[model samples]
Target: MSSAGRALAVPAASDIVDAELVNGDETAASGVDVRTARDRHLSAETVAAIEASAAASTRRAYAADREAYLAWCRQEDRTVVPASAETMAEWVRHLTVTPRPRTDRPAGPLTIERAMSAVTTWHLEQGHAKPNMRGARAVLNAYKDRLAEQKDEAARARQATAALPAQIRAMLAGTNRTTLAGRRNAALVLLGFATAARVSELVSLDLADVTGAEHGYDVTLYRKKVRKHTTNAILYGTDPATCPVRALRTYLTALAEAGRHDGPLFVRVDRWDRLAPSLTRHGRTIGDPAGRITAEAAAEVIGRLADAAGLTGDWSGHSLRRGFATAARAAGHDPLEIARTGGWADGSRVLARYMEDVDRVKNSPLVGIGL
Candidate 1:
């Protein structure tokens, strides 16, 4: 026979049997079984292939939403399996009527739409030939129109009670400077207003981030969430005329006079000025001597200061940022300039939200008509 034909040919019964089996012995000539070792670890190439098949952020969001829906299904005594379009449509309807947790809010059109998108993504990721989310999509669209109307009504309500910039300034003027804590609180409020920083970013500041320069002190912001896309910059030219930064410098100098260093700039000081790490989420002590501050701590500082200053009207960490934008625009500063200082790419939307028509009324000549 040809060599190729011999290679293709199946072995006879005598040749197919192992020599060890024929001899009634336990071990082969090589004393190792290849099949046993192959079952243990996967090859490096196979591991890399599995890692490459992992889902992106959007897909993960969809999966989370789908899991929420499935949990709801079990609670409602509905079939957990989503095999047909009818079940999907029913789930969409349930989402619209369902009451959300911890609030008086109902699951409106927007919520239903997000749920539908998530469920559809889940089916596609599982390699299904055809997803049955068409009915869910139709229900979502109907709910979305209703949600838009509700949003418009809520926006109109907000326009009626918009706080004036002068009111915020008057509130800041009331902070006491007698005690160390009072002075620190005053400085924090001023810094937040001047920098227009998010509460989280403001509280994360360290002593190393601020330094004295020839003109004035420079404030260095590091890895701030707002400046995530851009390189961190130093804010120079800070003085008393600048408001908050000046107040912060005064507080820092006071700390320096006491020989305090090698710790966070904003430490948790009690009534006696003794420092402690701020309490963490699980009530454990955060012992990082120069560690970052939590967003919750920043919010508490704002609330406490507002109470001490006798300021009213839904104040939170966001109040400082919003107040800064309003105050800057009122002082005739350009929107783009304010945005750049606040770490926003553009300030057009912020200006539109906070700037009233009364502020721009001088551009028209009709105000001088009675002359």
Candidate 2:
């Protein structure tokens, strides 16, 4: 938006607290007291940092949960904020019984947990007393048990299929390398797989984050789920056609030629084969993100490439991460080595899950036994 247009646009949901403060309001504009927001004496930069602390998707989920809870409270003529333990327990029950919009099924346990967390976050933000959730969790457990009895699909865990190095090569082979989009995808896939970086981390990379190293490029992942730690991992170059470093060099050269020497490492390509327009965190044409691709869009790039390669299974951006672990394990790398590349906590159950069954057939004890 232009200067005047920007000046006139309403504050977003996130900025409501700050807006009220800026207007010299003693109270909040939102119905909730927002005591926590009120109590904060942070600078605009600090507030912006706080707003950016959570991932965009996470913030959106919390907001949606708060809205749903607020709507239910208003509809049932119950208190909104500072909810009682009974109220919370009843709320979970309501979520379990109510059919999710369009879907006939009620909210699953994970959804219920997230919803509860949303309400908790809202209450905490307002400095309200934490509503005891023991009763609520008990109810959620019962719901899970019921689902387990029925063997509901919602009860089963879903995992992304791993796209091993060979599959990744296939994806690159099928991609139209003559185009900007293809080059970008090639770089994204290679770097993500090589480092076992999450889609979020992959998109979080800025041009400055990557630096040339002896064998490959050393990638500094500044933005991550665990804010306290920033990881530096190498993206080794090999096999000229599918080399992550080579692909990145080609992509970065193209990006530089387009006058994009800085900003996000990966960005959108317009249908016209040009760099996409700058986008804000909320996808407005202005603000922080100067054309960085969202996690969802990046995932689609992987899926689309996978489809072009005629590879099947539940491929996604996560496939790269999973593939890294599997591939590393197959190559006889230790868990510590794999963990270092991917930032998985030592002994993380989820990481262990990915490595499970990977060597079952290949390294079976019975393989060399005589029949």
Instruction: Give each model's whole-structure lDDT.
Output: 0.59, 0.80
Candidate 2: what lDDT?
0.80
Model 2 stretches astray by more than 4 angstroms? 1-48, 228-241, 256-263, 276-291, 345-349, 357-371
**What value of lDDT does candidate 1 attain over all alpha carbons?**
0.59
**lDDT tens readout by residue for model 2, 1-371:** 12112222323355554443467554554565555644534455555555665677887887888889999999988898889888889999999899987688788788888999888866656646568998988998998888899999777666898989889989888788778888898999988888888898889899988888776678888436545344565555467877887898889888988899888899989898899876545645663348888788889999998898899998888999999899899888998888876888768788888778476777788898996
Local lDDT at 302 for model 2: 91
lDDT of 1 by residue, 1-371 (tens): 22112222323233445553556445565544544644544555555444334334444655577788788778777664444687787788777766778555656554556667766644443334335778877876666666676774322223212223454455556655555565666666666666677666677677877766654556655424343522233343234433555567767766666566745666666667644445566877555544444667767777765666666667677777777777777778877777766776453555457555435664467777897
Q: In candidate 2, how many Å is residue 105 off? A: 2.6
Residue 297's lDDT within candidate 1 is 75
Candidate number of the best TM-score: 2
